[model samples]
Target: MSGASVLYDAPGPKTKARNRLYSIVGAVAVVALIAFVIERLGAKGQFKPEMWNIFNYADVRNNLRDGVLTTLEVFAVAAVLSLALGVLLAVARLSDHKPVRWLATGFVELFRAIPLLITIYVLWVILLANRDALGLSGNGPQFWALVVGLTAYNGSVQAEVLRAGIVAVPRGQAEAAYALGMRKTQVMTTVLIPQAVRAMLPTIISQLVVTLKDTSLGYIITFEELLYTARQMSTNIIVNGSDTYVPVIIVTGVIYVAMCLALSGLATWIERRGRRTKTGVAPATAAPAGDPATAADTGKDPAATP
Candidate 1:
């Protein structure tokens, strides 16, 4: 029997009908809940056009712009650093040396076990304490704290992802590399790393999206990132005698969703490109026009015989 059949039998007609009905009922319930929320919000004047009008103000727009730029800056730096760190950690974890293996394992397990928020908070405190000694200026301390915390956590996760991919690679590939007189470092760098990255690209991008979203955590350290700026706008701005919290939240949420969607789209494009990439050994060079070994292999000169 197939594995799926062993797990559970295929649903009968009655069971399938029941499942369809359940899905319909669940969908109706969700729609009703959404309608109810809309009605309530409408009654409270939260859907008023004026609520969204705050974005028209130069100051509000500028704040949002700055917030977005800052968030992207942190994400870009953290993503690059995290990927780099992940590669090193993954290689070290797979090292023959017991010390290196143990160190990488402990580091990955330690950071991955700790909550990301706590890590960011602790780093912020430490950086703040020694800002002068580190030559941190302006938002330097907050920025580095958030970036480093993200790098540590996401890098650990990515290391495990890469390690899984590396392990999944056929053992023959490494054996072949060794047979060709490739050193361990050369085999890893030129052979293993590229394949592991290609195989694990989607998971890596997903982790990067998480890293992007987590930039919002910088707000806890009073960093004026997009989410932080949005929070301020939501609380401070008023429209029709109520704080513009709902509209601000909705707009901010939309922006965040758009960003994630864009990232996902970019990842999809890259994945498609990677799939289309030429791979495997190059086609053997055409036997130099009239080589005798080529003729012998073919039982005659291919050019003359065929």
Candidate 2:
């Protein structure tokens, strides 16, 4: 017999033994599955030295580097645009006016319900048709289409996440701001939105990761982004009478994973900093000439500062 938590009862010795047995069995099964996969891959010559030799070439490395650069470019642009769009949509949805709220709701629902790939394809067609008028050249149309499409979908999701965070904030804070004669916009921008952003940052970063992966869809629009470049390389490059697709795919997948891990690590670092550092203005030092430094020490009274 052992201590039990509030939510669940503690397992007895027999139950713990059973659980350990199950875990061992599960681990063995997973190991066996991995071994089987490696054996199959070995039979297919996927790990052949010649397949990996292509990576040693300068052109191959440059092609992969270009792909990674393009992917990052799209992700950066889309992340900024999506966050901006989310802010606008969230504000609009929270608007006092019925028309504005309804319009924002419709826009969000429409984009959220539409498949992202379809959105990208449709936008690509429209952009391609008006390329000259839009001054789009080379991969510009595909780039914008993918970027805008990612913005639309991710923005809608981020809007919902932010809205939830905003609503989660204590209602009294907004009322206090209102009591202080602050306008709705000022209250929202200064008090509400900041709290909302801080609360929903993890969700926002997760969505940004999704946006990063979504860049791969640019291949459908003929955007020469990382995945597209890798695909082309795999199709063209031959080693020992076999297309070097496995190596290309493995390398491309690793790059994507690395990029995502880096983004997650960055978000984690930011979250940690946000925890360690205080928000808003730093505490004022002792009052000049001592008009009661008590208020200055506590940071409670603005009039106490010189």
Which one wins on lDDT?
A: 2
lDDT of 1 by residue, 4-30 (tens): 768755889998999899999999999
- How high a TM-score does candidate 2 get? 0.83
TM-score of each: 0.82, 0.83
lDDT, candidate 1, at 131: 95
Q: Could you tell me which residue pairs clash in candidate 1?
A: none
Tens digits of lDDT, candidate 2, 1-306 = 444455565879998999899999999999999999888987999888888889999999999999999999999999999999999999999999999999999999999999999999999999999999999998889999999999999999999989988999878778878988999999999989998998788778988989998999998888999999999999999887888888899999999999999888878887877665433222334324343433343466444322
Q: Give the whole-model CA lDDT for all candidates, comma-separated.
A: 0.87, 0.88
Give the clash total for candidate 1. 0
The alpha-carbon RMSD values of the candidates against the true structure, listed in the order shown, are 6.6, 5.7
Q: lDDT value for candidate 2?
A: 0.88
